[model samples]
Structures are given as structure tokens and as C-alpha cells.
Target: MSWSMSLTSFPSRIQTHPTIHLLRPIKPTISSPPKFPNLPTIRSVQGNFDHSPITPAKTRWETMLETAASLYPLYVTAGAVVACLKPSTFAWFVKRGPASYSLSLGFIMLAMGLTLELRDLLNLFVQRPFSILFGCAAQYTIMPAFGAIISKSLGLSPALSVGLILLGCCPGGTASNVVTLIARGDVPLSIVMTVCTTLGAVFLTPLLTKILAGTYVPVDAVKLSISTLQVVVAPILLGSYLQRTFPAAVKFVLPSAPLFAVLASSLLACSVFSENVVRFKSSIIGASLASDLSPVLCAKAILSGELGVIILSVFLLHFAGFFVGYLSAAIGGFREPQRRAISIEVGMQNSSLGVVLATSHFTSPMVAVPPAMSAVIMNIMGSSLGFFWRFINPSDSKDSPKVDDK
Candidate 1:
């Protein structure tokens, strides 16, 4: 009997054959099983597997939402932790408050400027100019009006009322674009609106505040405009020019914007607290007492209790701005994305600016409460809204109607 063996390089295996008994080397024969008698003979199946179809890509809005969803928790947590630690660092922060607030404002303006492009400005002449314009109008008009109404209705003190109006009059926050993007809104449009409103605010904010807040509290439009232009417009223009001219420079500035903003805000918070401590020390000490406390302590306790009111009013106004801004956009023929953008843009005022203005001009720490508290509340509320939108939307994983931009 002959036996043969073959080695296959493809599978790296040795094949043995028992049919051949002689010592002859040859290729082995492999065959399919024979069909049973009367059974149908099967041939083969052929198709193109390499060129199979795949799911479509997600839209820009969908991508934005996913990104926002991922980062929102960190933003909220950071803001909360910072705020909780304020009391301990109060004195240090207050001493450098104005400078810190100014730095933050400058950084935010610079970031805004860097983000802007010529094409974005050209978008003003495109199909949805009215949408942008109306959105801006709604933001400036409705928000301040609501603030004024709320302040009056609540019978808040003059300082609180003016603070609310000041907050309302300020431009949309930097965070607005982020929230708008997450909500699947037109991010470019949001950015443009923010830039326009912010620039316009260099002049308009002072004018509007003087007109609206003057009735409630003393205001100096000229001084306010100068301050705003110095802190907001100048930095923004410089940053935008740098971004346009040297794109790489933005890398350094972008990360620094938030850091500066945080630092500035912390300083502003400290300044306000310190001023409050100094001016209303008696009242605060009095209010701090639990009740049936001594007169010396009673003063501190009263001031401390007033802080609670200040915090509450700030929260109320911030939330109200957010809710009203979103609802107004939705009612005004805006879709989900645009509405989200509008809501955020309207809701989150530039509270850092408000703080700076209040502290520099008002001389009363109480006046700064609305803006400082607003800064904290807006971040929390904006983050919450972003998270909620993401929770419901969940990127492009779920089926949604395709947006028709025509």
C-alpha cells in the first residue's frame, strides 16, 4: 500500500491520504459530499458583500448635542464646587474682585471675537436674517421687561430691582452658544447673535440700563459704556483679529478664557461678599442669629438674612429668563434647535459684566448680588437644560425628522 502526504503553506497543515499505499507524493483531492439519490442538487449563492449599504451620517445639530451632553456634567460640577468654596476665600477674592471680574470679561470677549468669522457676519444677509434679528430683539426686549416686572411685582429693594434690570440688559452669555449647539440649534446663528448683541451692548447696554434702570436706581450711561467697551469690546475685537490673522494664537486663548472667567468671577463674588460684610456687617450679624439673639449679633443676622433674599431673587430671575426665552422662540416659529439657541441666548446674561458694573458704579455690594447669583444660577440651569435635552434627544440614535433648511 502507498501512502502520500502533502503540506499546504496557506493553512500551515499536513494532509495525509490513506487511499494511496505507495510512497508517491501528489496533491490530495477534496470533494463535496455526494447528493443523496433523488435529492435536489444545490449550486452556489453569489452577491456583493463588500459594497453593502450603511446607515447615514448624523447632521451637525446632532453632533453638537452629543458633544454638549458629554461635557455638561463637568461644567455643572465645577461651578457648584467653586461656589460652595466661596465663603472660605471671601476676603481674598473680594480684595481683587474688580480686577478679577475685568479679566474674566476680557477673556470672554476675546474668545467671542476669536470664534467669529467673516462668513458668520455675512450670514446676516442670508435667508433667516429676520429670525436672528427677531431672536435678538426678543432677547433684549422681553428679558429686561420680565426682569423689571418681576422685580417690581416682588417688591424688591431698589438695589435688587436695578440689578435684575442690569442683568436683563446685558448681552447673551458665552455659554449660550454651547447650550444652543447642544439643543441642536443653529450654532453659527447663535454665535452671530451673541456677537452682535455683545458689540451692540457696548453702547446699547448703557443706554438701555440708563433708560430702564434709571427709573429705579441712579445710572451713568457714559461711564457704563466706557467700562463695557474697555472690558468687553476691546478684548473681543483684539481676539477676533488675532483669530482671523493668526489662527494658532486662538489655541492659547481658548483654554485661557474659561480659566480667566472663573478667576474673575471668583474675585467678583469675593468682592461683593466682602463689601456686603463691611457695609451691612451689623445687619448681617443680627440676621445670623437664630432668634432671641443679642443686639450686636442681631445686626449680623439681619444682613445674613438679606443675603438669602438676594440669592432667591437671582435664582428666580435667571430661571424665568431661561423659561421665557425658550418659550418665546418656540412660539415665534422657531424649531427645536433654534428655540434652544434662543432660550440659552436669552436666558444666560453676561453676569460677569453685570457684577463689574455693579461693583464699580453702585458702591453697594447689595447691587452686585443679582449678577453674582445670576452667574451661578445661569450655569447650573443652562447645564441642566443641556443635559435634559440630550437625555430626551440622545444623539442620532433615535429617529427624528430631518431638518429641511429650505
Candidate 2:
């Protein structure tokens, strides 16, 4: 139960109960890396002036935006609940055209790409190839496998099963980067892992979804691959190129990019939920009737039937992913921050992508439900984990420049 025991041990310890207390006690002192002679001091450089001081207005604005960004879980939770209650609120986001899913996802991918630098990817592979490869491998393998097992164990319908499995096979979410930053984990590694898994999804997502979900329904791997390339790969590369070619424009857009992506993802998930509200209401009623022994138990029964199973199954899948991912990285001899990065990367699936793929490729709207629900659940879980680690590991401050560098 000591920090020195290596992070791989978390799975075993947390299996009985995954909670904040599972972390070891540590002094709240910051840990510093070894110092070298005559190293240059890092400073933020703005184009206008050599000695321009930060103004109160500018600081307040930055603080306000950061506060908003950190409340992502709140926004997502509210959005999901509203979408379920009144479909019209989010339905318009998708009704504009057939390409709504693709456009939303493309914009999200473009925002992610703008944050990345080519050297960041290269440096990650060159410096810590094992961690990157291990994370990507776990991303494709562990979650997909867990998804199928959890789906079958829960005895979900074929459509729901496929949706859950598709979610499992998807890439690490862009939000994982922000969560990693909050958790004081290896941000560079998180970003690199996200990029690697996302690019790898072009091949792995379609193929794995076909292999794992084909039994549930017909899966056209070729179509999925093409769609992924169009929605994901192309936009990301375009944005990355844009960042390099037009640094000025990128600088202007970079501050708002993460928030935009977060909002887009929330809107996309809400839109899907809105589209399926009728079916959802009917299912809730049916499930409640099936379990209720008397009229008095009607409300309670709905909480224990189909909806309950879906929520439980999704929770187990992600909890297992976060635990197993940490174990895997610990086994690979990585320490605290890298293990945290891998855990978050593996656990947080790109739910927005899952929603798009399920709805676009599958005939049933029900197939999109799990992913839509996941958009809410994963953020809550990720943010909780981040804040927990942030408290215990005070030494891993967010202000450290090394956290941003590979």
C-alpha cells in the first residue's frame, strides 16, 4: 500500500472497491526532476511586447474559461438529462442534414489535431515507444474484449450488444487529454496515446467491430473503415497541417478548441438520445411493468430492469478498463503518471464516434443508446478520478512545464 509498490498493483487492491482511499498516503510536497547547469528558463512569449505584464482582465478571462472547461462533466450530465426529458432541445443539432454526425465528429477531430504538433508524436515514439504501444494495444484489445463479455453477461439485446462493443473498440477520447492534465498525469504521453489510438482506429475499429459485433448484426468493415477515414483521419491531418502552416490562425483558435470539441461531443450525444426518446420511453415503461409486483412499485421497477442493466454493464466495462490498463502499464515497468495516463486513455472511449457509427451503419436506433449514455458516465468517472489523484499527488502540479513536454 505504498507509492513505491508500483501502480500495477491498483487493480488487485481496487477490485474489492475502487475508491479514493485506495491511493497510498504521501507527503504533499512537490517532486522535482534533476537539475542541469545553465538550462534556459521557460517563459510565455507574446508577440506584442518584450515586457508586457499579465493584466487582471486577461487573467480573469483565462480563469473563467478554465473553470468552464473543468466543469465538463456537469455540462454533459445536464445535457443528457435534458435530451432525455425533451428531445427537441438537441434534435435540431442533427436534423440540419444527413452528414450531421460526420460534421460534428470532423470538427471535434480537427480541434484535437490543432492541439498536436508533429514532433510531439515523434518524440513520444522515440522516447517512450513501449508506453505508447502498450497503451494503444490495450485500447484495441482490453476494452473490446470486456465489452463483449459484459454485454453477454448482462444478456443485452443484439443491437445493444453491438453498440456497447462498438464503443469498446473505439479510440481513446479527446477528453482524456484534459482529464490527464487535471489529474497531474503525463499530459504529453496522454496526447500521444490519444493520437496513436485514434489513427490506429482507422484499421482497428472497423476490423475489431466486425470481429466482435458481427454476430449481433451485419458489419460492413469496409464501410466502417471508409467512414472512419473520412470523419476522423482526414480532418485530423488537415488540422495538424493547418497548425504547422498557419501558426497565427491556430494560435487564435487553440484556446477555444478544447471547449468547442467538448460542446460538440455533448451535442452529438444529446442529438442521438433525442432521436431515440420514443423508443426509450416505451422501453422504460415495458421494463417497469415487467418487474413491478404492484402499482406502488412502478417507479422503482424501472430503476431495476433494462435501464439498470445498461448502466451497470457500461460501468463495469469502463472500471475494468481503467483498472486493467493500469495493471498492464505497471507490468510494463512504468510508474505513476504514465500508468494514470494509460488508465484514462484506455477507459474513456470516444463515445461520440460510437454514437455516429451505430446510428449511421446499424438499422436500429436502439444500437446508439449505450454510446450516448457513455458520454455522460465516462466524463463523470474520469473527472472524479482526476480530482482524486490531484489531491493525493500534490507533487504532480499542473504548472510544471515538463508535464507538457515529451
Candidate 3:
């Protein structure tokens, strides 16, 4: 079950289907000068393909794809903000159907699978098994336990506490790979950690949530396990199969996959927000910390109560994860880039999956709030951290080459 990413670029040149036109570099052609030196005829041939028929379209297509990829964070932020302002727009995306959230999650997972190849994964594990293992361990260990501590320390409500715990117990997100690349971190380590945690989530998410959140409410680990399998595992495996069997199609879709996943996640987050908008509005203004708590605890409680305990709980969970994850990795003797990767991976939970699971399993809309809010908060926080890290040089260049999953 080991894995590695292929060096080959997506939308590979292996086009098997007819009627699918791929843009390829046109070979350079050397033309002879005019036969007669006296009367020179100028041919409109350009070496840079300006004269080629397909150049404009190809350039435009490539630019569009690049733009989408570059603005992923912006798109996600805008979607969440807009959904908060007017939930109706995104609410419609979910209203049309049964399994809307599940289907959207499945689509995101499929896109992730298309980007992965078994050969690439195997190469990665063969080269750096320890880094991957440490990252996965951190994701499962640091985040979940810290989440419970934060929730309890804040004294969150039952639904909000459970939501925070679920957010923590969930796996690393696919988005972490994108952030790692932006941060110039260990992309391979990030991807491998994400893959490992996601697969492990079938057991870990439910088991941890039950253990941590069981105090808040009765949790059914078996039910959560089945739901996770249905949404996460099946689609990802099917997508991997399709990638191997129908690479041409996968290639066609690969360029758009990440952006598509972002959009899908945003929509899912917004929908959850919309469904609980009324409760959300009321909850935000409802409570505050009393004199019974310590000064530090009282300050956090005040923020949580005023801002809606769910948002504050989720924020503290991810913020603590980012800080502690990096500190722990640095202490473990990992280089800066590896520490960055571990931090982002640990901080960004599969929030969409959290939203989906909460919506499907819990009766309370409040339960889904933390994850939905996390979808907005984590990206902004992760992106900011990534950009900050991008300017700093890694401690060792050797660490960079060994963990480059790209």
C-alpha cells in the first residue's frame, strides 16, 4: 500500500481518444531563404509559434488553468464570505439533491486521486518513510488531543465541543499539498501524509471522536466508519483505478481538479452555514464568560461566546495545531520545510468531510458549524503561514531534494 507521485506532468501526451485536441509544442522548422537572392520573399513563419493556428487557444487555456489554481484561496474565501452574507446562493447547490454533500466530497477525493500515482507513492515511501510516518503521527496525535483540550478549556457547548473534536480527529486535507508547495515545503511529505491520514481516518476519525467527544454526546463509531468509507475511500480508489485505466480522460480533467475541489468544498461549507443561519445569528450574540473562570480561560470564553463558540473553538484548534505541530517537528530535528509541511498538514483538517459527517450523523446544525467555519478559517490561516514561510530559507538544501513529492 505504499505510494509516490509520477514525475510526468498531467494531461499526459498519451491521448487515446479521438476528437480530443491537446496542445503540444510544435517542432521548430528551418526554412531555406528565398531561392533567388535578388527578389526575397518574406514568409510569415515565426519561430515562437505566433504563426501557428493553435497557439492562441492553447495559451489562453493554459493561462486560465493557471489563474484558477493561483486564485484558489481567494475563491474559497469569497465563497465562504458570500455564503455567510447570503446563504441562498450556495444553499441552492445543496437543495437540489440527496447526497449533495457526500457527492461533493466524493468529487473532491476523486480529484485528489487523479493527481496521485502508485509509482510516485512507492518511490516516495522508499525514499523517506520516516518523515511521512512522523507527519501522519503528528496529524492524528497532536490535533485530536489538542482539540479536546481546547474545547474543554473553553467549556464549549455540547454540539460545539463535539464539532471541534470531530474537526480535530479528522484527517489532513488535500489542500495541504497545495499550501506546502506554495510554502516551498516538502510537497511529497505533505501529500503522503494526507493520503495516509485519509485512509487511516476510517478507523481513527470515528475512534478518536468517540473517545474524545463521547463525553459530550453518544457517538456511534460504526456509523461514522461506514459513512467515511462511503464518501472517502470508495471514490478515491475508483478515481485511482480510472486514472490508471483511462489516463487520457484523467489527464483531461486533471488541470481543473484542484480548483473544482476547492469550489466543491466552498459550496458544501456555505450550504451547511445556510442551513443553520438562523441558529448561527442568534448564537453569536448570546453568551459571555462569567467571573467563575480564570483570567486566561475567561478571555477565551468571552471571545468564543460572543463570536459564536463554534468559530472560536475551531480557530483555537487549528491555531494550536499549526503552532504545536511545527514546534514538535522542529524539536524532532526536521528541517524548516519539513516542519512547515507538518504544520500545514496538522492544521488543515478535512473540514468538508467533517461537515458532511456532522450533517449526516448529528441532529444538530450546531454540530456542523465548527467544521464549516474551519473551512473558511483554516485556508486563510494556512495560506498566510505558507506565504510567510515561502520567504524563509530552509535550514538544509538536502532536506528539500529528498522530500519533493512534486
Candidates' lDDT values, in order?
Answer: 0.65, 0.77, 0.77
Q: Please tell me which predicted candidate would have the highest TM-score against the true structure.
A: 2
lDDT of 2 by residue, 310-404 (tens): 77878988998889998887676665777788899999999988988887899988788899889888989988998888776733434432212
Model 3: per-residue Cα lDDT over 141-201, one tens digit each: 9989988998889887898889889999999988888788778776767888898899999
By lDDT: ranked, best first? 2, 3, 1
How do all models score by TM-score? 0.70, 0.80, 0.78
Model 1 RMSD vs true structure: 16.4
Poorest lDDT segment (10 consecutive residues) of candidate 2 = 1-10
lDDT score for residue 78 of model 3: 84
Candidate achieving the largest lDDT: 2
lDDT of 1 by residue, 289-400 (tens): 5656777666555634666566666777777777887777756665566666777788888787888888788866677878866766777788788767755542332243
Worst 10 residues of 3 by lDDT: 44-53
Count of clashing residue pairs in every prediction: 31, 0, 8
Error of 3 at 291 (Å): 22
Candidate 2: regions farther than 4 A off: 1-59, 283-300, 394-406
Error of 3 at 22 (Å): 55
